[model samples]
Target: MRILMGIFVLAIYGGITFYLGWNLRTWLLAIQQFRWPIAYWIGLYAISFGYFIGKLHPLLTPFSIVGSYWMFFLQYGLILCVIANLLIAFTPLTTKLVGTWVISVLIVLLIVGTYFAYSPVIRNATIEIDKPGEDMRVVVASDFHLGVLSGKGHLEKFVQLSNEKNPDLVLLPGDIVDDSPKRFINKGMGDVMQQLQATYGVYGVPGNHEYYGNEMKQFREAMEKANVQILMDETILVGERFYLTGREDLTNKNRLPLSKLKPEDNALPWFVMNHTPNDLDEPANLGVDFHVSGHTHKGQMWPNHLITERIFELDYGQRGKNDMHALVSSGFGFWGPPTRIGSRSELWVIDIQFAK
Candidate 1:
């Protein structure tokens, strides 16, 4: 079934690539009398499919970086092409004119989207809980995707942002690294992350990407050396104030359920770090006080958020279910290309007030 699904997805991707390439070919032919079909097709496919090809090995980091950018280009370009074709068909608009408009629009989007991608914004929220404790400020960031495309610089920015907030605790819900933590480790990003300042400590859960890398031991070692704690199906008490349970990413089939992970004798408010927001009902059903997650990237690109919205009830931002408050970050890093359209790279600063 998985094989079939993969093949089906690839087929659709290939079809789209062909459609886009053909349309662009037509535009080039008419506009500039561009005639290098061989070179054009090779360049187009390389950019379009580079991400997947690069993912086959860690050495092809350059290809992955270039290919990732194609994701947004493909999405927006395809949309523009479809619209342009429709206008040309229905109206008296010529292909050359529509082509010019579409290309110009894409250039503008590229510039604006790149700005949003690189500029990480802070989003603040306040939550009141019935548990007794001091009001705490928690800085939560996720999906650092700290690989070749997103390196030490982005991590430094995240550290600076979180430290500036003077958080009581720093929590990384997941995807702290890209598919692999190789670049993060080699570039000494862990040393940079060690600079994150918080009253309690820094902690993180594994995102599916971590599992994809299949290098948990190394990833854990790097994080620990940098003073960031990795929580598998583990629970810890923060200065006797609250309980934090880090659930293994859904990628782990054998990970414990919330019922087993949560301490039965606990009275303090419990905060759960879940990488993906799919199993939200479990946390709510288990009476978790707060649940935080990432991995959605809120569709990182435009209109993609629409798809993510359909997949998860609370795909982005804060929502409440029963007594549990859930917050999902769009993530602080990009997945493929460092380009975000509808979503901006964000760090969430949550102010939690407890009952006296």
Candidate 2:
């Protein structure tokens, strides 16, 4: 069934590309006065092919595993080139297609240089909890996508950044591993897990991608080796003042049982962690004090942010209802294309101070 779905998607993608190419030719011919350079056509073709390879390589096994990181870099290069080409094409100045292609290639180089040289340090924010005397600092990062697109180095960087914050607790909402940890055994997902540090400890829940690849067990093991806890339909009491609850992906299971939590048990603040922000309406009834999540990487780029905002009520910031505070991180990694045109990768620092 999955195979059939994959084939159907590929077919649709191919059809769309063919249609675009055909129409593009017609548009070029209509504006015949400007001699479109051969270089422009060649560059466009290369960019398109690079993107296609990046998209499809992960479906092929050993090849997918080895090519994942390479594919990310390649796609990043192609996108910058494509953007530069578009810029030159739209410029008021008239130039040969060759000049446009050269400019586009340079743009790609500039993008690569700028990104590697100055990838921004992760940003941190603090949230105050309703606990008294004791305060808990929670470091939150989501969408780490730790497979082919992002690797051990990126994961290490994330850990280093999180450690710098010296968080008491670390929360990974979901999409920590892109596909499967087994795909890159030598890459040592387990080793990366062991490096994570926190005092109260780290907690994670499965995201959509983990379910898609059927890698939840491996993912859990990796986290466990790192001493990180996987919280599924469970709750842990913190410092005798607050409860941290984690639920499985909301979309996977509807109508979770809240009977286990008594209304009289609200002695401390309650924080709920889930992958997607779907059940905000229900948690309020359950008397949750706060909710934390990340699935929308703030669109990871432009225009898409607009769409995500429209679809989700609490897309990338803080919101509240009935005493429940909800925060959605923009995420810590990229999905497709490996480039973040608008949103930067994020690391959330929540400060919970107890009330006297």
Error of 1 at 130 (Å): 0.9
Candidate 2: regions farther than 4 A off: 1-12, 19-120, 131-133, 183-185, 254-264
Clashing pairs in 1: none
For every model shown, what is its TM-score relative to the native structure?
A: 0.96, 0.75
Candidate 2 C-alpha error for residue 221, in Å: 1.7
lDDT, residue 219, candidate 2: 75
Per-residue lDDT tens digits of candidate 2, residues 1-356? 99999999878755544444443454455456425567655544444455344445555443443333333434343454455457657876333453445445646654663364225355555555455557678888888787665777777778888888888888999888776666435587667667777887788888887777677787787778767788877788865656778777755666266546433577778878888876577777777877899999887755578988888887887777776778898887766545565677778877766666
Measured with C-alpha atoms, the lDDT of residue 149 in candidate 1 is 67
Residue 348 of model 2, lDDT score? 80
Kindly report which residue stretches of model 1 are placed more than 4 angstroms away from their true locations once superposed.
Answer: 1-5, 57-59
- Output the worst ten-in-a-row residue range by lDDT, candidate 1: 258-267
